[model samples]
Target: MTVMMMKVFHVLLLLNSVWTLTGGERGVSCHFGKICVFPCKFSPGDNILIHWHLTPGNVQVHSFYDNQDQLGQQDQQFKGRTSLFLDQISEGNASLKLTGVKVQDKGTYQCYTSTMEQEAKTSNINVNVKAPVQKINMRQTENLIICSSDGIYPEPHLSWSTSPPSNRTFQNQTTVQKTEELLYNINSSLTLSDREDELEYNCTINTLSDQRRASWRRRPSVEIISGEATISCSSPDTPLSGFSLVWRFNQRQMIVTKNEDDEQRVSEEWKQHVKEVSESGRLTLQHLSADHEGTYTCEVSKDGDSSITQVSLRSDPGKGNSHVVIGIVITLVVIAAVIGLVVWRRRRGSKCTKSQKVKKRENNKLEKSEDNQDEEEETKMNSS
Candidate 1:
């Protein structure tokens, strides 16, 4: 058993906590408070030493030698508590065994080799503990569905989808909340036209199970729109994949753009002047602004959902509006800056002013010389 006793804890920088380098000692894995065993991945004739030291509080842990008979072990904190599984050492498996584990062991651990040809190699291992997700909930309001879920492990992902996979019409809201490590929740709403018939809702949470990820779905049928800006959230009957998404502006219907860029720009423009879409196939106009001050149309169909919104700037001639006043203000600022610059340059020093004047005079002289040359060329041409 090789235990290096130091005044402070010291962990090796290795690539793997459990691997073997071509010329170094092997790797190892051991838990806290229990008997941790490791193998030295090296031949019997190898001239090397195996050592272990933990540094949560600066303490020399342990060490062992291969060819030479050397002994410089640590204090009693790690007497019978540490050792190596020597049987596999000659095979180049340098694994360390720890008899006891402390909370201070909750940091990066490594296994390394410093022999010839193998160069330097190590391994780093990060250990963590997590829980599980056990519950999910979803509620519907108007044309939007607020999805809430909890009791998840390994951080669950939240998404809105179709229950039957028809890819029907719907919008996603942006309000979300994370309540716990294993729990999360978000709320999204869709807009529906008074003409729409049905809407289905889906909320999915993804988490880990047996080191594998599993997806859990929570779906609920929601209400249909009976008025403006309202949407329905319910599953459709014929598996909605074929249904076209519809959009409307104010009360006018519009067409959905097939090109992706056009759709994205349209959506961006919509957010600027309108509400986003909800899973219920209804487009929402978040807040009314002067930018939102125009005739809008919502278009819905079987292919996709889109909207065309107009905007009008309300003008008040009596009291100059912000846009006009801002321009005047900017013009005044520029004028002031120019005046300040002129005054500063002119008053800074007579030497600078004189230099500028000389430069200008030289430029004028050059122009006169060029002009005279051109005139003389013309006269010479006439004489010829």
Candidate 2:
């Protein structure tokens, strides 16, 4: 045999020795619409061949052969979504980063790496894509009612409903947006009736595997300009101890917290503005300014049940209260005037009835006299 043949035989023997050497299968969890990485590492070299395949069909996802990436046979579903750490490949890192992970991508992946001598090392990764975190929000401006949600996956479906059926047709507007992190953000709006009474609104977000719903009913709005503002979240009287209250601003910054033991904590930025923390989870902010205008969320937990309440705050404090008072006063004055007018009409109707009765008696007396004259004329004719 030639000398090259002898070296080839020795390398083949070495490959057979380490062929069964492999790490245990690892479990990987990935969020839907997010990036998922399957880790594989080895000694850095250019003579290594890495092959990745998905089980159940043994579909080739990616392959690095002959010192180059060979992807002509990659599955269409994983096209453009699969990537290898090319920069670190020379350093023996064969990790794959999969972007925009979907439910269909959940399965077992095999990483097979072989050196120039055909010595092989294998590793298995079981990937699971998780559902996205969801949150729903609602807002109202004059006659417009809007509902929105953020950080959802798989293109969520949104719908709106009302408690009492309204005959009026609502204008619906919906939009879906993808963020830099590959999460879906949805916004939907419905124009509401101009009714003064409180209305019940329901917003539902649906995914293929999960469905979450949120109900929002109209609450009495309070506005204060340059004055103290109070937001409250209270529950029914329960003997359960260990209650906790948390307040958030605009769904981002936490403003205050009160524990069941009556301990209080406030945010540093809002320390001066936070005036009081009631035992019932009421937050009072003093010396409010335009900067305080936003949505305030109050979360209360007792026992094991939790409740959330959101309040919208604005800066037109004086106008809102004054308008309410003026509207009440105007309504009261109009009602009083209507009552006075009704009383006047009743008195006039009574006087008119008395006058009609007197005229009717006079007409009856004249008719009787005429009838008496007619009877006397008839008697004289018979006697003649």
Evaluated with TM-score, which candidate comes out highest? 2
Per-residue lDDT tens digits for candidate 1, residues 110-149, read 4444443344444433333233334344333455445554
The 10-residue segment of model 1 with minimum total lDDT is: 219-228
Whole-model lDDT, model 1? 0.43
Task: Predict model 2's lDDT versus the native.
Answer: 0.74
Local distance difference test values of all predictions, in order: 0.43, 0.74
Which pairs of residues clash in candidate 2, taking residues 3 or more apart in a chain or in different chains? 225-317
**What is candidate 2's lDDT per residue for 254-312, written digit by digit as tens?**
99987888688898999998988766677788867767788787766654334556678
lDDT of 2 at 132: 52
Any runs in candidate 2 off by more than 4 Å, and if so which?
1-29, 33-50, 54-131, 163-170, 178-183, 222-230, 234-265, 285-384
TM-score of each: 0.26, 0.45
Report the backbone clash tally of model 1: 79
